[model samples]
Each structure stands twice: as C-alpha cells, then as structure tokens.
Target: MIAQVQKPIEEILEYLEGRDKVVLVGCGGCATVFHTGGEPEVKEMADILSRHGKEVLAAIAPPFGEFTCYAPWSSKRLSKYRQEIEECDAILMMTCGDGLQVVRESVIEGEFGLLKRIYPATNPTGHMGGGPALFKEKCQQCGECLLGKFAGICPLTQCTKGLLNGPCGGSQDGKCEADPERDCAWMLIYERLKKFGELDRLREAEPMLKDYSQMTRPRKIEVAPLVLE
Candidate 1:
C-alpha cells in the first residue's frame, strides 16, 4: 500500500481552489489499515472542505468495518465506485501511493474520463514496514543488501551511509550513529546471527560491493503476455 499524508486544510482546500462540486475518493485498503486514512478522517476532510466554503459533492466508500486486504484493491473498476468520484469536479485519493497511481492510470485508460485534478492525502510508503513500523524518514531505496546474512538486521538499510558491511566502529554501545536509542544495525545483525547459531555464516565475507544490476536507475518490471492474459 502507498500513502500520502495531507495535513492542513489548505493542501486540499487549495485544490478546490474555487470549484464547488469537489469529489473525494477514499481508498478502502489504505484507509482501513491506517486510522488516519479511514472514513472518520474522510468525513473530517469533507467537513473541512465544506467549512472552507467548497461543496463536497460526495464521500464515496464502503462502511467503516470492511477489511481492505480481503477486499478489492484498485480503481480498476472505478465504475464500481465512479459515481462517488464523478459527483465532484476533482478527486482526492486517500489510498497509499500505488493505489492512487493505479487508479489514475486506469482512469486515463478508461472511459469515464473525469480526471480534472488529483492530490494524494498521504505519502506513498511500501508494504515492508507494515502497520506500526512505518518509516519515519526514508530507506534511500538502495537496492543493495546486508540483510540476507545478518539474520535480516540490515546495516545498510538502517545506516545513514549505506555502508556495505560491518559497523563503522563509530557506533557506541550498540547504539546507532544517527540515533543513540536505535541499536547499531550491524551489532543487531551480529547478535541476531549469534542467537540463531548462524555465526559460521559470517565467515563467508560478502563481496567488496554490491552487484550494480539492482542499483540500475529507474527500475521497471513488466510481466509478459502470458502473465497478462
């Protein structure tokens, strides 16, 4: 699930920017999982828009109790939910980043063509961190790894320099360079392996650097026709 955080009435109010029949499309998946993305917040958003003097054409979504994962996860069948979005002049997606992108792409590819303006209510975050482990900052999205061996404790994914291996020796008492409260990623990795009795795996020194293939810029993945069909 991808997410965009829209705070301050202005970010959305500005989008209304003199239009009244504004439509808000709330994502069932992102909203159900995260408290901020759900219908109460959507209602508050609608109220905010209404208070700002814009007419909220409608707020379209299933009732609050539906489970997002077990439910459909796209705008692919916007027709299933198009009327809500169509009721207004614009769309405000409360889904994660990918959901919004998928919807927008589909709308562009579909017949309802009501795409006037769009805004993300939350920043898109990947599915890795799950619910509570939400990334406070970012991963740098470095595709390299120090995780497969270190019992999944990643010095690189958690480290600031993206160090390929081992601690910089700058970590004090297992605390990280970036934050003392956070454990040094390498140290945590080391401890994890020790606990799992996989210390022998550490003797296998990893390569001097990562394979650049994964580092290739602007990656894109496409399934062949067999997968599509």
Candidate 2:
C-alpha cells in the first residue's frame, strides 16, 4: 500500500484561498490506513473549513473498502453529490497523489468534463508493507524480483544503500551502519540462507548492476476487466 501523511493545515488553507465553497473527497484505501483521508478525517476537515469561514458544500468519504482511486467506485459515490461538486469552487482530495490524479483525470475530466481544480491534502511517502499498527517501506517496485536469490529478503529495499551483492563492511554487531538502530539487511539475508542450508547460493555470482530499463514511470498494465457471474 502507499504510505502517506496529511499535509500541513497551513498549506491546505493556502490552496483554499479565495475559494469559499469547497468539496472534500476522502479515500478508503491507503489514505484511510494511514489516517490521512478516512471518513473521520474528511468530516474533521469539513469542520475545520467551516470554522475558517469557508463554505463546505460537501464532504464525500467512501467506506473502508471503497477506494477513491478506483474510478468506478468514486464515480458511483460522487454521483449523489454531482450538483454540490459542480457548484463548489474547489475540491480538496484527502488522498495520495495517485487517488488525487485519478479523481481529477478519470472522474472530473473524463467523466464529468469539468475543468475543476483539485488539490491533494496528503503527501505520499512511498509504497509500504506491514499492518494493523505499524507500516514500513518494503518494496521499490524495481521491475525485477530477486527474492529467490536472497532467501526472500530484498536487499535493494532493506539495505540503506541498496547493495546488490552484500554488506559494505560497515555493519557492526548485526546492525546497519547507516542507521545503527536498524538491523543489517545482509545479515538477515545471510542468517536466513544459512538456516536453510542455502549459503552456497550467495556465492553464485550474478550481474551486480541492476537493469532499470523497465523501471520507467507511469507504468501500467491491461488485463481483462472483472465480470461478476
């Protein structure tokens, strides 16, 4: 999931300058998990704007499973607020850049054809994994899978410097040199491989340089659409 944090209220207020009537849109996916754009946050934002002398035309917050980044879900939920959305001077997206752009391009422009101004209320940190209470960045989406070689550990993301081969001889007492508090990624990989009697795999040399040709931006894939029986 994409990890993010809410932008400062001062920055959000700056975006709302000269705009009286505003519509707030919240996400139900990563934004909710990160406490950035959930239903409660949306309602709180509405109250804040009202207290600031701004007229909040609508506060649209989808449930925990309805993602604002998904056009179908957003379109369906937003349909009820069509009049308010069209009349609002601005739309505040309490979501990551992905959801914000999707709502702006796919919903506002593509579906409604409104040249509406949409602003993001959250700043995305990065793609992360882990749950319930704590989350951490675990993947870089490097377009290459190397877990099979590293005993399921991703050195690129886990390592501070993204070393492809092994530790940089800076680790001390199984702790990372970059961040002494963090465990050394290579040490973890080595221990896991040794436990499984796969230490020889580490000796098997491979290309050290990462092939980033396929790591282009705006990557997309097309698959058959979901059809319910």
lDDT per prediction? Answer: 0.62, 0.91
Error of 1 at 225 (Å): 12
Q: After the best TM-score superposition of candidate 2, give how far the Cα of residue 163 lies from its true spot, in angstroms.
A: 0.6
Clashes of each: 13, 0
TM-score of 1: 0.75
TM-score for all predictions?
0.75, 0.96
Please provide, for model 1 over 128-228, each residue's C-alpha lDDT reduced to its tens digit, 9 standing for 90 to 100: 44556463433445566556766876655666556656777889988887788877877877788889999888788777677878868766566442221
- Candidate 2, residue 126: Cα displacement in angstroms equals 1.2
**What count of clashes does model 2 give?**
0
Per-candidate RMSD, Å: 4.4, 1.4
lDDT of 1: 0.62
Candidate 2 regions with alpha-carbon error over 4 angstroms: 227-229
